[model samples]
Target: MNKTRILDVKYALTQILYFASFSALMGYASVYLLGQGVSNSLIGTTLALVSIIAVFTQPMAASAVDKKVIKLQSLVNIILIGTVILSLCLYFFELPTMMLLCVFVGIVTFMMTVQPLFNSMAFLFEKYGIQINYGLARGLGSAAYALASAVLGYLVEDFGTGVIPLFYIIGNILLIIVVYTYVVPKNQQHLVQHEQQNKEETEQKQLSFFQFCALYKKFMIFVVGVVLVFFTHTIINNFFIQVITPIGGTESQMGIAVFIAAIVELPAMAMFNIMRKKINCARLLKLSVVMFALKHLLTFLATNIFMIYVAQVLQIGAYAIFIPASVYYVNEVISKQDLVKGQSMVTVGITASGIIANFAGGILLDAVGVYHLLMIGVVVSVVGGLIVFGSIEKKKANVME
Candidate 1:
């Protein structure tokens, strides 16, 4: 195959492996903890810890990539290896509760950092005139996630939650093989050097945190809107199993529900390039937030498991479109010198929201119940949607004048 075709195939395969690993952990980690007799509140605490650590880890990882402290592929490989080792340690050592929580926190911290690295690398490659087809690659990742969730759901049901770590190990192993075999080493070196040159050209001295904030004030407002949307999104994702279980959904059914949610993302993600051609990223983001609110509303009203599946169909607009749109929006708004930092800022929003969602969702899930918690999500999501809509409208109006 030609170089472009080869790179495209490698990128697609890498995405599939990356997301499959993510699904094995994030998709079922809570349910696995539940099966292990962990309380809903504690599960929330664990997830919150993961998000909190990720708040620090993602920015650090992004900085490392930008500064050439480590190559992108090298960083990814190291994390995946750490993940595999941690998964095995969690399973075999069967450590005390606190230690297990610590391991889980490490695993998720590493996993959360991976996406930003992938995104930054994709943009860097594109900047160098390489064609990676990020939308299609991300779509394939969603497809892999769906398949892994469904199959692992059944496996977890038949074998046990202990199977979760095993799946992580297997997924990470495949990811390592793909990265080492198909990924071209020279391309990575070129991307890293290019990023470093841009950084040095734009920044002779690193700005203080306050200086950086002042420079990106408008982008900071946009980040706040993104955080609000994810605040609701993270709640639903972390507590999805809890939401369905009270309605008689089993382990396998939980898998099916996630499967439906992820599968629907495929077509929307695959068509993101076309959608971007027709719709500006800001409008697409606004639409996504609105759909996010609607999805929560429908889930709040769902009385049966089937209705939950119906609600998941909205994932197309909510999550599928949101992912690509947000990436494009960041690239459009942020300067090249601050590219990695900008992407990390967006991830920080997501991680911060996840922190709130896990802690609050856990507390509410235990005190009130799933239905009541979902109602809170609906209210928050609508407010978030309005915030995003207003922000986008004001920006447009300013441009018109």
Candidate 2:
């Protein structure tokens, strides 16, 4: 293989290793907490707190790259090692105290923001004639999630949820080694140039908040639509395990369910890459919006566990396409200097959506039940989809003008 291809492979492997364990932990950890006798409110609150902090931290993390505030690899190493230590420590703690332990772990892991950082790295690599394919690298993460999730499912079912802490310990250790040793090298050029450019831009442009809003108004509308879509989906994701457990699905089944969804993302994301060249992203996004709305609509009609399992195929269109497309599309409009802030805007939207989804989903589950909540998701998604559809047309009109 050529040099670029080789680097791409290495990059993909490192991300796969990094995200696989993390996704597994994310998909199953709440269940683990529940198994430990924690209440739903506590779990939701803990996750919300982490995401709220993460919303603030993402921009800071991206700023680290933009401003040369910290060594990128150093931050990853610290967070990874810190997560492992916290996991090991949690094993020694008792009931109510473990909730606090999860909270601490969430804070550290939440701040371990790398997606935008990696995007910047990829952009830098393009300048070096070593272009890293983001989608392919990201697909490896999906594959890792599939494998790790399968293992976690069986482990959770056979051993108990207590094994989760051990899994976290092992996973983060592997992540630390892969990232510190392989993905990031001690190269100063990307960081130095990025810092200098950001410094120049800061000196040149100091727009007021209102001015900044006006500057990104088009992208902002897109973000708002995407956020609402995310809000509806989080209703499903945040409570999926809780919804399935009572249905007699084993931890392995839960694993398989998430595995199925994550694996489906590979082909779905590939489709987006092909379609991006042929069709407009806004149009593609509308298709995803429709798909998700249909998905929840169908879910409201599902009766058996198998029906719910099958309905998740809709996730391919819902998350995989919508997310990457939104990111790539927004990049088209924003200045290079504002890339991190733009990406952070996307993250902030997601964080805001997640908070509302979790709190609202919890209440809906308490009031009407999971299936009924699917009906609510259906309505919310339709509204979000319509907003995107209108925005797409308005953008097209602006271009013509």
Q: lDDT for each of the candidates? A: 0.81, 0.70
All-Cα superposition RMSD per candidate? 3.6, 3.6
Candidate 2 lDDT, tens digit per residue, 1-401? 47567678767876777676676566775786678776676666666666666667666876665566676667667766767766766666763656554655463454355545556666656655566887778778778888888788898788888787777677677766766654444475565557657675784575555666798786677678767878777876767776675566667877777778788888877777788888777677788888878767765666566876787788888788888777766666566656666666777788788888876776677678766677778888888877777665323322211
Candidate 2 local distance difference test against the native: 0.70
Clash pairs, candidate 2, are none
Error of 2 at 55 (Å): 1.7
- Give per-residue lDDT, candidate 2, residue 122: 68
Per-residue lDDT of model 1, residues 192-226, tens digit only: 56666686556646665577679878777777777
Question: How many pairs of residues collide in each model?
Answer: 0, 0
TM-scores for every candidate against the unseen true structure: 0.85, 0.84
Candidate 2 deviation (Cα RMSD): 3.6
Q: Where does candidate 2 stray beyond 4 Å?
A: 1-10, 64-69, 98-111, 114-133, 183-187, 190-209, 212-221, 331-344, 394-401
- Whole-model lDDT, model 1: 0.81
